[model samples]
Target: MNWQSIKEQLITFLKDEVKKTGLTKVTVGLSGGLDSAVVSVLCKEAFGENLKCVLLPSQYSSDGSIEHAKEVCEKFDISYEIVEIAPLVNAYLPNMEHNKLRIGNFSARMRMSVLYDISARDSSLVVGTSNKSELLLGYGTIFGDIACAINPIGELYKSDEFDFARFLEIPESILNKKPSADLWEGQSDEEELGYSYKELDDALKLLVDEKRTKEDLVKFGFNSELIELIDYRIKSNAFKGKLPTIAKIQWS
Candidate 1:
């Protein structure tokens, strides 16, 4: 995919966007996942010492995730801070039943809140790590992982992200680990979605990028059920990708 060329373009994009915003620094939530790791590397290249990587680990975050995130910061020589969000999350949902989805969404939002606050404190813009696959499928929490000042990887699909991460020399541990939001123990992105990223990305390329119809997908050897499910997710979660709707009032 000409990753070197793409990498140069992305680094340039980050720098130009930050300049346009009149911001001198960039902040990112380093999740130790491929997506965030790639963004961190790009931000490091673009901002150099001006990049601030923050680790907002919740109670559910695994030790391995935190360690991996720190490894990226150390490897890149980027400045970072770890802000534990467990206290805040626990205070908010002390007695609630343990719901994986609910807790995960809340954790995402809390982490973002920490990032935005850090951005303000550091006078830096928040860089997003969400890839095109998640955005298209509405697989992220609204006002959470989806929130950012600028997204360098939002247009790259998950599979493309993996390639880019490797090209950027992200730690093999991060690149090889199962993709997760780390919202809970034993949580995996593919397991939750019921499809591997490679499978989903292939279908998405046909369905969204190539604008293929369901019949065309089936003709291309895609299962009807999978196509239907993906199409439904895209349609249903469309709201997450858009600004809030406002009612138009007629003047008297």
Candidate 2:
């Protein structure tokens, strides 16, 4: 919330993370969305010119998103590259059965794969762009955008993330734009989730983080059926947050 203090801490946080991983630079996938924009700026403040922004776009990616990503990178003097993943994704689609969900998942994974490749080439860690709202609501792909060497904004909610964006003085264009994963054409994150962030975060605060039950949520003005639905989603997707489960045997 405090820009002065958060700025100081972020610089130190990024420095420590880079040191721990023995990387002098950091890379982030800039989606032209608020979360990635915030991450890019934070990494810039921390790592300076050592931060690189990669725009891994596919056919579903909008031109507006790409231009905005480039604009932000230029503003901060961070190096950037726009890599089109459409060809790569299309090349692989033929060999695999394709569906909307499958293609969406593939898009996420392909973006990650490109990021890791660049990370290895540049000796930088891939910085994550997920926020608390997305993480708690199971709104991200497991090993895709969800994967990162270190995340500075993952703890902030979608609303809180926008607060930090203002603190970092992000461009209004990015700030005011709709939130999207850009995995498919014309897909907005909120539209897909069937709720706005304001509503979702409020519910998540009571339901997931606060450990409230359906009745408790109903008391807090949430619909009983909706609470149950959210509860089911969170529990069912809990596996995504954990490392692969392993079977254990009784030991002597």
Model 1, span 1-252: residue lDDT tens: 899999999999999899998889999999988899999999999989999999988879888899999999989898999999999889878555787788899999999999999999989999999999999999999999999989999889998788788889999999889999999987999999999999999999999989989999999899888899899999999999899999999999
Which residue pairs in model 1 clash with each other? none
Go through the candidates in order and give each one's C-alpha lDDT.
0.92, 0.84
**Candidate 2, lDDT over the whole model:** 0.84
| Model 2 worst lDDT window (10 residues) | 223-232
Q: Considering every candidate listed, which one attains the maximal lDDT?
A: 1
Candidate 2 on 24-83: residue-level lDDT in tens? Answer: 999999988899988888888788889889998898788788988988988888899988
Candidate 1: lDDT of 43? 91
What is candidate 1's CA lDDT for residue 203?
98
Model 1 lDDT vs. the true structure? 0.92
